[model samples]
Target chain A: MSQHYYEFFCPVKVVAGKAALEHIPYELSGLSASRPMVITDKGVRGAGLLDPVIEACEEGGQEIVTIFDDVPPDSSKEVVRQIASAYREAKCDSIIAIGGGSPIDTAKAVNILVSEGGDDIAAYAGAGVLKRPLRPFFVVPTTAGTGSEVTAVAVIADTEKSVKLPFTSSFLLPNAAIIDPRMTLTLPPHVTAMTAMDAMTHATEAFTCLAKNPLSDAHATAAVRKISTNLPRVMENPKDSDARLELAQASTMAGIAFSNSMVGMVHSLGHATGAICHLPHGLCMSLFLPYVLEYNLEAIREPLGELLLYMAGPDVYATTPTSRRAETCIAAIRKLRDQLWQYCELPRTLQETGKVSEDQLEAIAHSALDDGTIMFNPKETSIEDIRNVLRRAWG
Target chain B: MLAKRIKPMALQARRLYVETMFQVMGRALQAVSEVDRSVQEEARALPDGFLFEMTVMPNGPKLVVEHQGDGRFQYLTSEPPRPVDLSIQFKHIAHAFLVVSFQEKTSVAFANDRMLVDGDIDRAIRMTRILNRLEAFILPKLIAERAVKEYPQSLGLPEKVLSAARIYLKVATHFVETARAS
Candidate 1:
């Protein structure tokens, strides 16, 4: 156990594998919820991913009261209120969120409004604000990355204020998470690579950060091994259902781990960089993973060394001496990054992204220092330290 | 009956420690808001009239401070007040003792589910930064390094000694004035 005292709670009933989508209506019926409101974006619907979920619900004698597929990539407070209105007007008894982080987060925010009886979400925009359980909710993630399906937090952009309002409560966790391979079969190779890297980063940071304990460590290691072994195979063959399923499950596992143990500087920097330069989140995670690990090397040396066993198989772990295992684990991540770059031109550096300039590093660093996750990092990072890491990661 | 009696006695001791710590913390925060550059910068980032509170739940010592803008914090009463901008409440007296005695860092306490914050997280994070800076000045390096996420590397021994002395003097003077007023 890394921590002497820790608390881990994941109430989400995860129903994964071949017929996970088919089980959604059964799960809903069990919750005594018959009229579900489906919240998703046009992209997931355009790709025809929502079809199976609808079919399953229809066949199970459930009525989808309404399908609001207009969720944006970056959901907003206004969007949440709009969805809440639709949910009420249609008399939805439950919520089934489909697609990735944005839609799921939107659904969670909508649940708060509908259940808590408020149009102003800003009134309830902090940690531990919700006092009661939300309406029955379920998530079927289309993207294999965000793991937002199981997290007890949601972030909705308050555009007028130009800030992201975060709501965190155990009440925000989904009643169940439905993970199926069919949802991710159409994901492009680059997306597959980047999202897997996001999961890998989540697991890696969870295992190494402060607050890590036995239970979260178990989930983190399992997630790391799954992503490491299966990411490359999926990158080679995107249509391979087994690999896709493993990656999706790994994403959820990583989500559960980080949600319990919390993530550290990699996420801090990723969030800051995304906020500043408008970069895709998965890309930012892939870009900064190695540099943040290297910076946190001394403070997290023991856990990083232990992670080598999961990142690379037993052959590599058994051969590397104890002192060198930490760096070797980082080297393995770097190799994976190189492979991802080859597979789909994922940017490995801030300079390569062509969106961020040298001057933006300071802003990113300032923003990163203010991020909540920075407190959980094993090593205390200074603004100058973050700037130095960004400079190193720039080229 | 003996076990029940002993529990209250133990609770009384822990409550005193927490109360004393809260008073000292309130004074130190008032001092740092005036003297520390980092705290001044952080305070400027916060909205004016931001009320911050630290307390133990269900009936324990409380410390409330109001930001009066221009990097100034006025220590409010120890009594619980209306909802504030940011409030960090230790779940139990023992948890407060762990943090007040420097046995556990603030972030560690949060990770252990020993405390809960009710307010905007961004403002809460800034409040934490201010607290970290306050801890760096008020506490000895060995102890502060454990209490805070990062002890300032810029403060040499001489600077730390001088800062601690200044903060401690303010804390003592405030307590003396309060005693006279009472």
Candidate 2:
């Protein structure tokens, strides 16, 4: 048996529940942030979730110098830098990121750029590139998905190059995460389904990937089982506080799992596909999950089978061989995607996205080949295999 | 036959580390009588009617095993005993157990102070191996059951509400997933 060593660490204080957003002042107080920058996107502001947070902070004697609500979807480095400069100009002592991944990630980038005084966000790309911690950052995720509040990585698109720069470091982890399902109550059905599937993919990949260890396995398994059970419910009833809580918890757990154990090809292909096609990351992930799993079955069967047992329950594994379990898991995932697609009206194929084509398959595959995540896949993958997976995902 | 008499709670307690401390121990003890016949035969050999005192502490849980039969047989942790035996510091039990289960190395964790064992070194090694097998077979089921009970609605939700919730969760889950995948 191969002896695998694993360590789990997510020190960010997670404040979760129905009115968990109210706990932000307490978390920020602990960080000694007197004047915090409330970083968010227009969507969150438009939804009016920022009001209570601002009110809560004001009631707690915390001053908010600026509300940078310019963050856009798939936030670019230019936007982050602009915000960072604004934050610095305002002399804000800390950051309070409120929204989905884009704003949270943009806040992380802003923290890095402002604190480290770097002109180019690209200079800090890759793991362990940062020499010091960023600002004292507190994250409140408006969406129930993306557990960006706790992860130690950020993705900022470079519009000039059309490439997403992934800056990773332990230092990028937020000081605290407030995951209140109420923040996600107003989210539309399509966004909810896609983000839930994104959370599911995180848990699934962490459970079945090569780098998975005991701690990650525990978190991933719990996350997958929870998301599988709760995502649908939350999608069906956004007002169901309990289901919303479960998805929030699943999102955080999946975040913790993949952050520690890492993810696999589904993500690699998704990243490349997202960057190239300008499709949403979750949409790309949901579209490619089954195809990539089908491609990886030969190498990932054993673990994937274990995951299948966790996902579909033991009955599915009772008569199936371990090697066959992987395929079954892939089929199960595809079935879920199909169900989700019908429910959310999400695009089921690359062609449905209106941008991707068979002609770009090679480029997408090549980009995936160069992605850092592919290196951790259980099976060795090549550009050719990636091309094949893309073609299959094209439907 | 004596093993048949062992309370279901005791069996579940034996499998406590598997997942939820409550459910696994409950199931293992409930099913104990049917699966392993040797447990009863071994229980017959225990001293004081197979009574074993167990103490779970921060370091490690300790069990004082006494023999009721002729000195030829030894008792450990309410189970039948083998030839060798050892005691571990209570705090290191879980760590030691995990290391032995995954690494298949009994002494390194103990020697490195990640675990500490007292008594016969040989017995400690044997116990680790047994615990490894016990964890592997029992943990997954326990974990699965716990997850199922924890989140029952994941199968499918009402179409109207599910459609709405999907949008938010999709964005959130994607942002985190893509970052980690990268």
Best by DockQ: 1
Residue A162 lDDT, candidate 1, scale 0-100: 93
lDDT of 2: 0.68
Candidate models: Cα lDDT each: 0.89, 0.68
Candidate 2 runs further than 4 Å off: A1-3, A118-126, A157-164, A314-324, B1-182
Model 2, A150: alpha-carbon shift in Å?
2.3
Q: Just chain B of model 1: what TM-score?
A: 0.92
DockQ of each: 0.64, 0.02
lDDT per residue (tens digit) for residues B32-136 in model 1: 887777788889887778889998897778899988899888787555356688888989998999888998888888778888888766677788878888888
List the candidates' TM-scores in order: 0.96, 0.65
C-alpha RMSD between model 2 and the true structure = 20.6
Q: Which one is best on lDDT? A: 1
Per-candidate chain B TM:
0.92, 0.32
Per-residue error for A28 in candidate 2, Å, reads 1.3
